[model samples]
Target: MTEPMFWMSVAGVVLAYAGYPAYLVLRRSLDPWPVVPRAWTPPVDVLLVVHNAGDALEAKVANLQRLDYPAQRLTVHVVCDGCTDATAAVARRLASGRVRATVFAERRGKSACIGDLLPTLTGDVVLFVDVRQTLAPHALRALTAALADPSVGAASGELVIRDPTGFAAGVDAYWRYEKAIRRLESATGSMVGATGALYAARRQLIGPVPPGLILDDMWIPLSVADAGYRIVAVDDAIAVDHAPPDPAAEERRKRRTLSGNYQLLHRLPRLALPGAHPLSLRLWGHKWSRLLVPWLLATALASSALLAAAGSRLYLTLFLLQAGAYALAILGRRSAWLAGRFPPARVAAAFLSLNASAALALGDYLRNPRAHLWQTTRYQESGR
Candidate 1:
């Protein structure tokens, strides 16, 4: 085994999980861009696109109504895309001067819904919220307020898992860690992207939404940065949802998202490494590096095995440690009791599942597939 290959593989793993996070912390520590939240609540319009979401449509509408923003200032548009169920009915029941419902006879997917909705939005700020989460009363206000800073074209709210007692707790913790990185990245210059669960963008800045499976969150934020604007993360603006009871549903959701990342990177070539994309540094270390991790992991294992066979005692120990971590992952899945008792095991397992999902996502990207239309991963788990 070449020593350089072995070291590079090790470095790749380090850079993705540890090095990048460390860099974010250090960068934020050295130069903090303070974002003072303002009371200037611009007119916020919510465009909610749904496909076969009849079960939770009423609850979603209720959540929208409950947000702390002014009744006159907040408008909700629910677009039911080919939903054969009571999705349209629920939306119609809740429709009023403040709430409106749009129905499409055929399913063209989320991208199509977004494309149709963008032109109709007249508010100063347009918020895109997924049907799966309920926004905290202040989510709309905080996200919209951030746009008061002219440099920030878009802002994403923090998605918080409302409950955390089972296997899902590890998943919730994982997101918390991710939010931390986003906060630092936003402070430094621009966050690599926004969360679709709850996020807002200046109406003038939003152009045509890309058609197909590309992630709107990443594309919109990156496009904003490309147009000389920044995307900030609004931590206090929280959107709450139930984490999946198990990793199965979460894996499917991640597969779609990670694949979209792969597809978006290709669609927007400027975001790739060695390109002039202003967010290239953050994208490379934070985003592309994650896409490459499964391969790096395989290389690390093989290289370590070869080195061990060649009598390198240190490599042998490293290989054993890797093997043990995988063992813990297996245990985490097979025994919930053990996982609950030892949280570290569950976190390690979730990490493995995430990377495995990324590998599946790469395959999905290669197949040149269309995005799934409005299938919330944990919809069933949430019992909505």
Candidate 2:
């Protein structure tokens, strides 16, 4: 085959495989139909995991107090691990006795902290909430109602990024698109993973996470799914929080997330279990493939570069196009601040940010295969 033809063929194959799956996810996400059932109240335990979360504890506690569900039926458990700051002190000051505060001065990972608190949970359902975010008043009811369906082992709310400033608006838009796709996947059946900021599951469905698991969001949902129940997304249930103001801070967050994805892929190979639903497949396509995308991207790029240097104009053009597309995406997101608009450019930026972080994460994971303690980034103040 001619050099040009070979490069064209390779590009076609990659586009057909990777590009098609992404199209399907985007198409499904754009469908504007409701998937969640109407709200009904059920007893649930609200698990708030905190580390050095000073005043933010107060806002989270206040949000919990404002939940539309019966206050008596709801219990809030705050797990404070390795917190030297007044996080524990602030939580105690706000506790009405309905809130149980578990303070551990010794630093254990968040996953381990969660494992420790699991046995103390007495509610029929447990909802994990990040101290930095606030749950919608009706989020609990919606999540609980979804859990009422026996097939749903866990349910997560829609995440609304509340950064009104342009600093992280790009990040917010990216999440909006993601949430849309997640909803569509859920409607088709099951969510790939629950949002860590706000997700609820049956207490019995909870299992011990690998002590070093960095991505509780991925692990918890996968565990529930492996147990034969669906991991669901409830669109009506919403949690509002801001993205990290600094791009560097956001990148740091993504790095940790990527590392967790790698760890989970290794520890929970059961994601390939039989009788997997479409949502599970979507999860695999959208997330699992993405975990290895960096390697695939790198290989393709290198191969294209070599083939082009060997006088394959077609292959060189294809490789350059892909690279240019990513470059434009990044530029578009960064330029949004100047233009005051959310454009197609931002979408490209979001993609670039995600994949770039994935690549960095793979490098970091390779360097340190063992689980290590890492600090969570504090982006915005948690309004108590």
Candidate 3:
């Protein structure tokens, strides 16, 4: 039983990283995403949140103004949350016609600020975005029309990481895999969440996020979906942001996000409960299983080592393979030759960092959920 369980854990990892994505490509090939016509133009509120994004606010505003959507039907609201810098000032300077700016004095977390401010906005659809990404000319229109099905509660746009240098990064590869998963989920009309960088929701579905919560993307879309509406992914509506320059930053971001997954399952236990959600199997396979990856990896490593010690040739080979990959990850961190710029190093490094982050996130979750929550709010206040 132990040996079988060990192999099962190994199979889970393979299925996750390999089989799942292939299944999506096959599923997509058989049934592609439905075409959403651009004709369904509706009043859109571009709700942008920023901290100290003074450097990028003006250009981002300009980018939005360049969008193909009708100016009369579109309104841009930039909310500056505890921005000590000239973020609000820059936005206010850029504010003209349909663009507006508001400043929040307190350093509340984004979820709280958005929850508080969402009530004041009146648009047929509220499109949420961060200050970093710049959308394509017709991205907004595509997103709006995706919701024309009326069955869609929210529509999440694809994010394209700017890799102009064509540098190979593990997170870049991961996003490609993630995009396929999103497409599969969208096909079933049960994508679990939206990309916070660019996604739109029905105005009526907009509501106050829970206090002390992070990951508004996951929470908001799930909330809307619970009301019997579908969450779809729109690959045509693409937004661009630069990829993280280093694995350290990527790990930090993943840690924060993984920690929020814990909180999400806690806050909305029904999401993980079988028969509770249409996406329950997918959630476990795509999202929640990820939370167990570190453990799965560890168990696979230990079990193989144990069996190898008892003179199993196959387990010995597996053990050696695991050891070699982990060694490569350590080398990737220390040597420039083995760094994230190359595919092997990047893939190995990304795998190592991701599992390490999962362990750290789980540790943080266990140690002090409230304290971590407090720290996250502080971080989100400054860095977002």
Candidate 4:
């Protein structure tokens, strides 16, 4: 084959294997699993790990207190690791008798704090939550009910981005697509991964997370799946939260996530095991492929540009289209005129943004594979 044809063929193969597989996995919502009767009154322990959380602590505690589940059956554990602010005091004052506070004067990582609290958990089910998010009133019940399935090792709630405006609007749109894909993957079998904002699993199925682990959420569910348990996502169980409004703040978050992806790729063997479930395969394709997408995209762009210089109009046209799409996406951020007029172009821009973020993340990963700890960015929530 000619050089231009060869490059196009390579791009086609990569898109088919990586991109098309994701499309198929995310094409449809999973059929609803039979609603299992709540036969067992298992004690539930909700673990909220906070670090220098500001005024949000009170709101989070209040939301938990208002859960529809019986208060007597639910216990909340707030782990304040290395919290310098009034986080511990706030937890103690607000929760009072309703919540238990585990304060570590020294700053161990979040995973280590979880490790310290793991042995102390006496509940049948352990639910993990972040400080900034709140679950729906019936979220606990729905998650617990889903976990009643013998094959399900863990269950995560649907994550809804509460506000979508400005830069966060794009992020919100992306999350909706992500939720749809997870729903489809779950229907086909097990979802690839759960959002850390809210998810629950049998206490016995959780293994001790490594102290250095940055993405405890990913590791916990993967561990459950490795032990032959299915990690399921329940649509009825919903958690609402917002993404960071600032693009730089969002970039920091993605960098940490990508770093964790690298760690998981190196550490998690169950993902590559032969005879792994279809769900596991789907998860592998969905998550890891995205991590490597930026690299692939870079190669495609460079090769296409080179082929275009060598007099291939097809390659040149595709390259120009890609560039124009990104320009329109930037324009979309400025005003509705561009966005409304070019919906397809905006979508392409969104995809390009995702690939760009992934590329930056891969660069960070390459520079320092050992870097794990990260300071959570403080960003304003857009009202839009």
Candidate 4 structure, TM-score to reference: 0.87
List runs of model 1 lying over 4 Å from the truth: 379-384
| Model 2 lDDT tens row, 1-384 | 344544554555465345645665665677533344555566788888788877688878888989999988899988887888899898777777688888888877778888888887888898888887777898888898888876788989888877544436666776776776676657655667888888999989877765666888778887787787887788778988766667667777788778777776666555544345334555565676666665666666777777778887887897798779777776765675642465556566666677789888877777775434556566666432
Q: How does each model score on TM-score?
A: 0.95, 0.85, 0.90, 0.87
Q: Model 4: per-residue lDDT, tens digit, 1-384? A: 346554665565476345644565545433444434354557899898888885678788788888888889899998887888888898777665558888889876778888889889999999898877777998998888888888888888988876555556666667777777666656655666788889998999898787867788888887787777877778888888775665556657877786777777667655655466444556556776576666655666677777789998998987787567667767765554554465654455456666677777766777764455556555453111
- Lowest lDDT 10-residue stretch of candidate 2: 272-281
lDDT of 4: 0.73
Cα-based lDDT at residue 299, candidate 1 = 90
- In model 4, state the lDDT of residue 362: 63
Q: Residue 228, candidate 3: how far off, in angstroms?
A: 1.8
List the pairs of residues colliding in candidate 4.
Answer: 30-187
lDDT of each: 0.82, 0.73, 0.78, 0.73
Q: Give candidate 3's TM-score.
A: 0.90
Candidate 4, which segments miss by more than 4 Å at Cα?
1-40, 273-280, 330-346, 366-371, 379-384
Predicted candidate 3 versus true structure: per-residue lDDT over 92-171, tens digit per residue: 89888799888888767677777877888888898998777778998998898888886887999999977622223666
Best by lDDT: 1
